[model samples]
Target: MNTLPIRPEIPWLAPLAGYSDLPFRMLCRAHGAGVTNTEMVSAKGLCYFNRGTSSLLNTHPEDAPLVVQLFGADPDSYHQAMDKTLEMGFRFFDLNAGCPVRKVTKSGSGSRLLENPDRLYAIAEIMVNKAGPGAVGVKTRLGWEKGVDTFLDVAKRLEDIGVAWLTLHPRYGKQLFSGQADWSRLAEVKQAVSIPIVGSGDLYTAEAGVRCLRETGIDAVMFARGAMFDPAIFERFHALMRGEESPPRDGEHLARIVRMHIQYTREFDGSDRSFRKLRSFIPRYAKGLRDIRSLRNELISCETWEALESAASRIREMQPADPLGFDPADVIPD
Candidate 1:
């Protein structure tokens, strides 16, 4: 019999596209995240030796317990990618079935696999068998549509096939983050499967994360958008669990991390590319500040690191809307 791996019960950073790259993962790790998964990588791309996709496998010495997530429907591609990933020194891997992006779903990958449990199971079995028992896991949504209990069967099937663990986002594919995530289904799915079940979806506050684990009895909690808003959330979660009050989300602290993020990104990917990439996240870092949208638009239009630094200097001089208590609800559009 294959032994089950010990599931990480602490708060983790969920794999987020364009956001959970190496520098961001390092920042979350420095805060308190026990594990950080890579953005969903394409197994087909790995099989075909795509250079851009292969670049996503980059890792740092500090990024231990990293989970590389792969998304694809081909078993052959999975096997090939597993070999390559192992060769690249990755010990933990996850199959992603929770992504709701149209390109991925239309390609018969991602959440589309939820429509056929057998194929999902087959692909997972192949991955686990090649990666060895307890080395491979899965992340998936509840089902293709709302009011469907398809995840119960999917979770059970994955458990029986010896998947290492399950990270469940309690939202249907059709919903695509439209409505509230039905966390009630998480409780039911956890009870249906023997494997560890980690809960995701709408976990913005430390209290919300604590509730998900306490109320639903999940093995752990994974933060997605929450981490984007504040990488220090991992630290906040730990403090809350220790019976301490939540930490302050002041402008000084936010500005410091934003600068640190910029520095780290520049070091990792160089100045120009990092500045371009940081555009998407500038608005997020500028939350709760006065005239942030306009500032964000200006920063997004900046062509060089010098211009970004100048813009950031202006932001530091201004006072935040609520200096001590930054609201998590004030999200800027992508």
Candidate 2:
């Protein structure tokens, strides 16, 4: 069987909703992410050529080891979408069966798929058949609810269907990242399946990712919220894997990250909407930093690229006391 372009040491970037765009993926890749995924695309949307769906397929030549994630309730449309992506040169695919948003679940996709284990397995089989063996993966939660954990059964079935790998978020659909990500469940899934398992959830730092691998014995980890808060988490993860000290995340270093992301955003998209989104995103990078709240307030009013660049400069020069605690990942409507 063909193995994924990932290992226990090389981390995968999660298919972040509204965030993991081509430019963002490229930025994370530059920092050391081994694999990156496109945000989840609706199969029906792609089949019908929805307005923004095509943009999600945008890629750069350097965006290798990339996976395109798809979500939908219709099997035929899902197959068609997968075929479309495969013909367009994408080699790896992931099913988004873990999103808890009502928008996704109401359509019988996302975590709703978890409630139908048999159907989930059947759809995964179709993915494997369409994408080819060792080229398709499934990403799902532990179950639809806390006490109804079905991941063990689901993982076994997916592996039997020849899925290249499995990425588990280790939380139920309704749990919605409310509590801790049970790393113990990851260990259970790893021992239950012969195929590779990539653990997700609650991995907010390089230390957390490394600790997950050591404790769970899983094949690898995929960083979602962690990467959003700190794209350099991948580089730090690599350092820890090599038994070397991770780079310092001083204010200037973080300022550099802010600058690079801004440059990449301008290079890829300099639209007003893009800048607005960046305004919101940059504050996440400042997570745990003192005197950053006021900077965040200032960013909210930055309407021009020049203005945003100037604010980033201030971020570099100002000496904040220290980083405060990271606010947990917010629950956004997906």
Candidate number achieving the greatest TM-score relative to the actual structure: 2
Give the 10-residue window scoring lowest on summed lDDT in candidate 2: 325-334
lDDT tens string, model 2, 1-334?
Answer: 1456668889999998899998799889889999999999988888887669988888888888888999987787877787788789888899888998888899889999999877787778888898887798889889999789899888888888898788988889998768788889999998998988899998888989999999989999999888898899999999999999989777798898999999888998877777888888887787666788789988988878998888877777655465534655552322
Q: Report every candidate's CA lDDT.
A: 0.80, 0.85
Task: State residue 320's C-alpha deviation in candidate 2, in Å.
Answer: 4.3
User: For residues 149-174, what per-residue lDDT tens digits would candidate 1 score against the true structure?
Assistant: 58888888888888978988988887
What's the true lDDT of residue 148 in model 2?
Answer: 91
What lDDT would candidate 1 get against the real structure? 0.80
Superposed on all Cα atoms, the candidates' RMSDs to the truth, in angstroms, are: 2.9, 1.9
